[model samples]
Target: MIDIVTVDTPHPYPPRISAFTRPFWEALAEGRLLTTRSVATRALTFPPKPISPADWTTEVEWVELSGSGVLYSHTTIHAAPTAFVGDLPYRVAIIDLDEGIRLATRHIGEIAPVIGAPVDLVAVRHTDAVSFAARSRA
Candidate 1:
């Protein structure tokens, strides 16, 4: 049986919004992946840039992203964030998606985090969401 850590109580953070990140936040609310596209060169970018960093063009556009990725790096956190009190000692990781974007998020599920492990994005909830789980190797 796989081990599961249950959070009895979870602290909350007041949601904050920013102009460049609005689309991403909104998409997450609707269970959709959101990324940015460079306006000048029409290149795809993650973390949603308002302008193309390469050429300083304001042609950044929002795009949907597939959530498949692989674990790049990870750590077990003993101290939780102030807003995540009950979830102390959680596993956090940097997942490198197939599109070559790397995102930092809490890693979940039964197995321990490992470098180069296959992972997939699963929406846990609206607020507490978007985590990666180690893919089972048969």
Candidate 2:
């Protein structure tokens, strides 16, 4: 497990979001979020895309999620990659949002999280980039 720390600096690299991903980013910027839903399989797909990987269908729709969920899994890392080195000992977690979509994000807040712990998504601004944090249970 990596000992995770909150990153005070902005992301060093530019996030690459394509045309299909524009809506998702836009929603985040607007405080309204969107994720892709596969019509055929009735599944929520994160890392939004125009087509579904399972059925190859271009029927993906942008759906808003509650942004509240539980921490499905996580790890605290002491050392990070070059770009993320400044934020050593940071917690990386997979949050299972209320809508049933699992999103990987940096864990934040006061307490260490455990599996099945309730968490809420919060948008945080770093020097130049915006990121999501999983808040510990209230």
Candidate 3:
């Protein structure tokens, strides 16, 4: 298990964009979630890659997900990094998307989430980038 720690000072860090990850970031900016799908096995990969994991196939495609998921696991952070300090006592959770992929995301809502509870995607905008949050579904 990895220990989550609070940083000494919050730094304004942005995600580094590479050739393979550009599309994913662009999609996020457009309020969409993008992933890479293997052409051969139809396997989907987050943190998009250039080659397929199954057969090393270079022919992969960009796919969009519905962004609906369930709360799989979580932790409440009393101490956070600079960027997130204002949102202390926030919940970081592992969400199991309906499409079968799991992602570590933040719960940005008022209520605490329950394990196995329904969640939905909420777009989160930073200074120069956009990410996502998992919130309880209404």
Candidate 4:
């Protein structure tokens, strides 16, 4: 089982919400994964866009991801952004989701993660925004 850490300090920089990204934020708020896929090419894209990157078509739709992925890479950050200064030595990981899309998210486990290890999505709420973390799949 994976553990979730709780910090008293909140994130300094909250996420900026806009119409284009509203659906994503809503899904994250509900602890679910939301992404976009091209109707023509069926290519998936993160940060959901109106137009498909694979094909220059405006045909896209919102799709729910499984939230299960493999930890492709990760890094420990002693130096962090102003908002994340309080949380030093935090782990940021790049996860390759089962949907075939890669998401760079925070790792929310006690120990360092292994490359190619399975990970699952965990929604973390701060004072200002909701962020996603990758935890051990097991």
Which number leads on TM-score?
4
Query: For residues 1-138, what per-residue lDDT tens digits would candidate 4 score against the true structure?
Result: 112334455656667878988998887877777888899888999878988889978989998888888999998899987767877878999999887888798888665699998888877777657767888755
| Clash pairs detected, candidate 4 | none
Count the clashes in each prediction. 1, 11, 1, 0
Looking at candidate 2, the ten consecutive residues that score lowest on lDDT are 1-10
lDDT, candidate 1, residue 101? 83
Candidate that scores best on lDDT: 4
Model 1 CA lDDT for position 134: 34
- Give the poorly placed runs of model 3, Cα more than 4 Å off: 1-12, 81-83
lDDT of 3 by residue, 57-89 (tens): 999999988888899999999988886777677
- Model 1, position 13: C-alpha lDDT score: 55
RMSD, every candidate, angstroms: 5.1, 5.0, 6.7, 2.7
C-alpha lDDT (0 to 100) for residue 135 of candidate 4: 86
lDDT of 1 by residue, 40-112 (tens): 6777776678777767888677877777778889888887767776667778788888777888877876777
**What's each prediction's TM-score?**
0.75, 0.83, 0.82, 0.88
Using lDDT as the measure, name the better of candidate 2 and candidate 4. Answer: 4
In the range 1-138, model 2's lDDT, one tens digit per residue, is: 111234577776646777777777666655555678788786777777788887889987777777788999999999777887777778989998888777898888788898998888876655665555687786
Rank order (by lDDT, best first): 4, 3, 2, 1
Error of 2 at 40 (Å): 4.5
